[model samples]
Target: MQHLLGLYRASERDIALILQEAAVLKPALLSSPPQSFSFLNGKTVVLAFFENSTRTRTSFELAVRRLGGSILNFSAATSSLQKGETLLDTIANIEAMQVDAFVIRHGESGAAEIVAKHTRKVVINAGDGMHEHPTQALLDMFTLHETFGRLSGLHILILGDILHSRVARSNIFGLRKMRASVSVCAPPTLLPVGIEHFGVKVFADISQALEQCDAAIVLRLQLEREAAGFIPTLREYNTFFALTDEALSKVSHKIFVLHPGPVNREIELSSVVTDRDDTSGKSESLILRQVTNGVAVRMAVLKVLLYDRA
Candidate 1:
């Protein structure tokens, strides 16, 4: 519980406790009369992001502030890293300031682990390359749990660029650990090697994957993957895999849709699907819920790591 590097490292009990805490905290976030907690009062948290992010970074910052903690935004562009300082060296210098915790997002896999290894302070992995994005997975789980009342035996399909998606890897670990039936749908070229061994069934046909699933999480196409020759073009990829309005109509059961944000308009998901509500009259923009739950989930994580409690 000291560090949330990946969901695979957390037991089912640990996951339950975090979600339970998030459930308690979420009410405060939505209260008409705003409320705040002082759980992290007198604590200082450093937001060290070596990667560009909008949702994750903003949510972590808001999580810390709402819990009454001081934050120091670390900018890699203007930092000593630009002057050839090693990642650890910069972190060591920051650690010298006696920060209570470090929320790190790095493009290199195991970067957060390295920080945790070298420092006595708590380290929460916001993201670390294609290895894991534990908090994102936690929020996604929270979103699902909030909607369906549980995760056990729920069929969830993660659709899109699997090869370069840290989100997919983390969700696969977290969802399966929660006893959800997890599957993935992606183009052959975009599917990573040995992904099926994670106890997830892989599907090339999007329609087949959508059938009978409780929910489908559409992923944003990683443009970098195209340069690497995993995909030929965005239009072609959309033709085969995009979650259009037409695709949702084919699903016989009531199915929900989830997407991690910064969505590609016509690529991973169609513009029509993103804006429309589901057949059940619920908002299809689970992306907004994901962003909202992110703060609560992160607050739960900070409480676990900082106070050793839910």
Candidate 2:
């Protein structure tokens, strides 16, 4: 509970508590007048993003301001890392400057763990390379719970790029912790070795996978990881694997579609489903709702971590 490193290390009770706190904070923080709570009033958080991001970075920034906190946006490119300074040295320097916590996204797996161990300050992993994005998984669960009223017994299918997805790994950990049945569908190349040991069913056919699940978390094809010949070709992967409207038609019940975005409009899902006018903020895709909940969830997490709740 002291550090939000990864959901796999967190208890079911802890996840439930954070989600509960988010539910309470969401209404006021997202209201028309947008009430701001000052629980984090004097704390300073550093967004130590070593990798580029859109949703995760922006939402954390939004959450920090909404909670009346201060944030410093850190860039590895501009920092001493470019000048041969070590990560530990950089963190030591930042911690000396009134920083209370760090929300870090790094390109290496276990990088957050290294920082969490190095500093006494709270560490929240924004993301770690192909390891786990705990907050993204938490927010995805938050969106699902908002729509379904619960996580238990709801069969969720996580489709795509499993072997390289930190989001997928975290989701599998979290959803299973909440008592929800988790399954994955991906090309055999994209699926990880011994994934079933994590307590999930695996499927090859996307249609059959769609038939059994109530909701599907569509993952973007991690094109960055494709250089190692994980698949035959990107075109072949998209043609056969992408979650399209035609694929959803085979299922009878509504299969809520979600993607921890920067959605690949061309490869992961068709534009028709993602291109809908959702200005009312009630998109059935639940994509936009996930973004909104991210701020609330991060706010709840910051409140818990920085409030001396240990």
Candidate 3:
């Protein structure tokens, strides 16, 4: 077992095994009193998120706690990182305390890899700028597994800001590894110059990409990454790639929608689409389910990394 620093370093078999493990573990997680794994009984995890994160941070902390591990949370503003502390120095201080794992998210590309290179402790990249989000990709695979019972042969459309989305990059690799058909839909300006090298079809029109997809994932449009002249307005981007209810209806009826959140609401999707209850009406929403799956996926990741099974 080793640190999951990036999706490119992971093999197709590795992706399959984690998805399989998550499926088995998810049932136990929902049981009344909850099933627990004792593999982490005496371990300590340090969550070092340099960037602000609501779901990834909280869910990972919860996951570690549930596995009987303790966690230390550190934010950039509250720590010496704000004072120009090197990533090595910051991790070294934590490593001195015998931390078993460092779950990190930073705003610079390759920041997690640098920490991993310098630290003795296992490193998991929660995210690294626009590089990758391996855990998010795993959780997404878990969600797809639950829905389609298989990852292969499913047409998945990744829409919106592909140029700056670590989520899209991670999903493309993980999905490709699992033999799923993946496509990207975004305005030309919002896509990377040579992303087709990843082997996914690129589409400028959302409707054309959605027509044959079994699932569609909307990457959160990162306003912070937008340059002054990137686009004229958010409304213009939405008009082209946002998955409104009408837009969703144009896709296959079997399509399931996904978003890595802090959703931009009407900007990425209409309120009616996000608000509609499925026929069952019992499930609160898909967003929360994605959040929950994140914990399970990360748990599987931690277990595999530390327990030497994956």
Name the top TM-score candidate: 1
- The TM-score obtained by model 3 is 0.93
Q: Each candidate's lDDT (Cα)? A: 0.88, 0.89, 0.82
- Stretches > 4 Å off in candidate 2: 224-227, 276-283, 308-310
Ordering by TM-score: 1, 2, 3
TM-score of every model? 0.96, 0.95, 0.93
TM-score attained by model 2 = 0.95
**lDDT tens digits, residues 144-248, model 3?**
888778888999889888888999999999899889999998888888999899999998777788786777787787675445667778878777778886676
Question: Judged by lDDT against the true structure, how good is candidate 1?
Answer: 0.88
lDDT of 2 by residue, 161-238 (tens): 999899999999999999999999999988889999999999999889888898889999878646888878778788
**Per-residue lDDT for 169 in model 3?**
92
Rank order by lDDT, top first? 2, 1, 3
Cα deviation of 264, candidate 2, in Å:
1.0
lDDT of 1 by residue, 1-310 (tens): 7788888798998899999999999999998775789999999999999999999999999999889999999999999999999999999999999899999999999999999999988999988998899899899999999999999989999999888888999999999999999999998888888988999998888779889578888888877777888888877888889988677767776667789888989888888778766556322657778888999999999988887642
Rate residue 111 of model 2 by lDDT: 96
Clashing pairs in 2: none
Stretches off by above 4 angstroms in model 1 are: 278-283
Q: Quote the lDDT for 229 in model 3.
A: 63
